[model samples]
Target: MVSERAAQVLVASNRGPVTYAFREDGTLDARRGGGGLVSGLSAIGTDADALWVCAALGDGDREAVRRGVAEPGVRMLDIDATVHADAYNGIANSVLWFVHHMLYQTPLEPVFDAQFRRQWDAYRTYNRAFADALAAESAPGAVVMIQDYHLALAPGMLRELRPDLRIGHFSHTPWAPPEYFRMLPDDVAEELVRGMLGADRLGFLTWRWASAFMQCAGNVAEDGRIVSSAPDDPRPRIRHSPTGESAFRTTLVGVHGLGAEAGFLRRRSHELDVEERMVALRDQVGGEGDRKTIVRVDRTELSKNIVRGLLAFRTLLDERPEWRERVVHVAFAYPSRQDLPVYRDYTAEVARLSEEINAQYGTPGWTPVVLHVKDDFARSLAAYRIADVALVNPIRDGMNLVAKEIPVVSDAGCALVLSREAGAYEELGDEAIVVNPYDVTGTAAALHQALTMPDGERAERTKRLAAAATALPPQQWFLEQLHALEALGEGGEEADDLGRT
Candidate 1:
């Protein structure tokens, strides 16, 4: 809007739809990225006048911005690299992520020393940069959507700058319960809650997480009259105001379970690259004699519970000896957050476990476990198609899309072994063999059940899973949020369908 091209809808996040990289010849290469958000933005069409604002993450991106490089419908902020690193790595990834996922060891971890306080300041500044940019670029009453924990503070700051703009914030990660969330410094915890409360509406992936957030918000907010709905209520409401005054800060909370785009996945899996990968995976699996395959694809994040999943697979083989040569585990443990020492160690542990399993049960003709660390989308889809059982067990997740995806792309059908902690459990638990992530024995049992399920039953379950999983696709999920924001009238009353789960 500063340049007179005022955008009607704006998206603010840590990463943009476009990224810049340098080729070997030293020329800047601008390439677009794709995901639910990208596809959803595209669905808005040209008339929406959408703009994406994101941080420049690398040297190429910084150079692109400095050289006045441009991408339509996108703006990249060249924040100071050091500040970004401290805020991103120190606070967002280390502190907030750990707390939300309940990853701390409690006895020896989470020492909030002076260094942490400094990083917290940098985090505030990082969020301020985004708020300032959003304020500068937004048209009057523009709908701004801030995403994830990276910009938790931005919504409140943006409200301070431009009160007229309709603001919404969505948390893509689990919301920690009040007890675990209070581990942060009291002042910091207060700031985070107030920051999120600045938005007119807040979204979580499931009712469980949305209710958890309301509990945490009510526990804090000293001056406000915090009115919270019951825990089991699908449409929970939270309003905050001064003790004697009417409700001034009415934040409608909602849960929008984002489903995979079935049409895209079904079409994409049939492409040439995917077909080639399918041939390769099928050859590797060698299902000629009815050998079964269990597929799992995830980054080596701490909360993903990759190590436990591997151990469960090992147990499945150890307890059921007759299945040693009858099945193979196809694991895609891609590297993630390698810059963090903990993540690197976790990834190494995964490799060590895979090697141990192969050494224990693998023969030359049949590898017991085929582990791939590299990221290849086609190969993942290929694995999905060939899988007889799909494993999606995470310690905590906002929503495990893989659990919903495999059913849509499987060649015949796939029995799902899912985690109770995943948001998808609320939707797919009836058809999935659910297990607690911490119970390796139980998870192995669930795996056995999934692998041994009858073909007719597997086909029936997959059909139902696919139907429920595709009920609200990604584009509709995003558009629903926009519609909710637009439906907020000047009178400041809740819409009829504003808080539907």
Candidate 2:
């Protein structure tokens, strides 16, 4: 029923498509994982001549790897626990994530000492494990698609091992500007850029991030200038030499704004469980009277700007006392990366702030702030259905799918209060209430406007916003990249001739 292809597609990332959990009886249960990357892969189907290589994160995963019981289309690599921790918790999450999100405290934080160097070594070793596994499993002339900041160096490592393979790297996080990126150790910063340059195609979620990457490359490249096609080109081929001794390669860079699966969301939102949750949420927000709901669903990640969102809600109550009990802020702040102490502290701060807001503005019959910190997809969908105003004010984000998703699932047309810093702004800015993420007063005013928007106006904007958000569905987003890579391989000069002599 399927045609055979010589070149297979290999996907490398920190986490794979499915995760395994072992029961007490020594039986393992495999569950489909969550994330934009996994969602995109599902678009390609299971029989696309594709193999996924990823790290085993938990004991269950490690045990599964030990038993050679990987999923149908996935391969899990179990590295030493210590090495994985240092590489993941240390370099990737602690260092790179902070840099890209611009979350470091600067003078008080990020002291890269001798211990950091050791962790950097572990990071390299961790990437090498992925490179080794991908190299071993890939078919001849396979197209390898690597994901995110966790495996930055793997592309170069894999290229060195197998020059014939076609490589593409996609960044799911914001690319730090040249100034902030230069904060890394000189050699390390250059290595990161050079490592990614090994890929034949590099994709970013937005043109702003793509420009930031090109600026960083220009700063680190040998000649201090990367040649490009045109200023308005969507996908441009740029040439850069990693070092004076290295030959220049023409690496193509493009923007692919990942979108939500509208069909999936529409179907899932109507499930019985979701409807039950919707009723519960309506009771929580509406109490005895029908109060407008300002909803935000986010993980307790620092860059999410949850604290500021709550503060703005407080500001709204202070500045506009007439709207006190008429509106409720329903926040679903889910737990994420709790293993990191910084994340734990941020989550605690979020709780404290939410409690403070509730204490400040509480009536006998209505609560101003209703906060939930657990992960519940159904509850989120329920909130989406009842929300009058959706607040997605991330300080910085790759795509912030929540901004796009809320409009798709809303019942009676929701108004979006979006952040200019979010990648979604590039597409949905014209329809949503755009706010500067740092300005509490501006966000408060924007929230007030969103709440008071005329029903007809809100409905029209929601229609346009939903259309823009789903312009490139996850399936189409992924297949477009694959097709672009395939075309590059077919039309370009030999891979060997492009990079080195």
Write the residue-wise lDDT of candidate 1 on 94-203 in tens digits. 99999999999999999999999899999999999999999889888889999999999998899888888889899989999999999998889878988998888899
Clashing pairs in 1: none
Angstrom error at residue 50, model 2: 1.1
Q: How far out, in Å, is residue 216 in model 2?
A: 0.4
Question: Which ranges in model 2 have alpha carbons more than 4 Å from their true place?
Answer: 1-7, 222-231, 242-246, 490-501
Q: Please give the lDDT score at residue 29 for candidate 1.
A: 93
Model 2 alpha-carbon miss at residue 412, Å = 0.5
Cα miss at 128, model 1 (Å)? 0.3
Model 1: weakest 10-residue lDDT segment is: 491-500
What CA RMSD would you report for each candidate?
2.8, 3.0
Angstrom error at residue 86, model 1: 0.9
- As a whole number from 0 to 100, the lDDT of residue 361 in candidate 1 is 89
lDDT of each model, Cα atoms only? 0.89, 0.87
Worst 10 residues of 2 by lDDT: 490-499
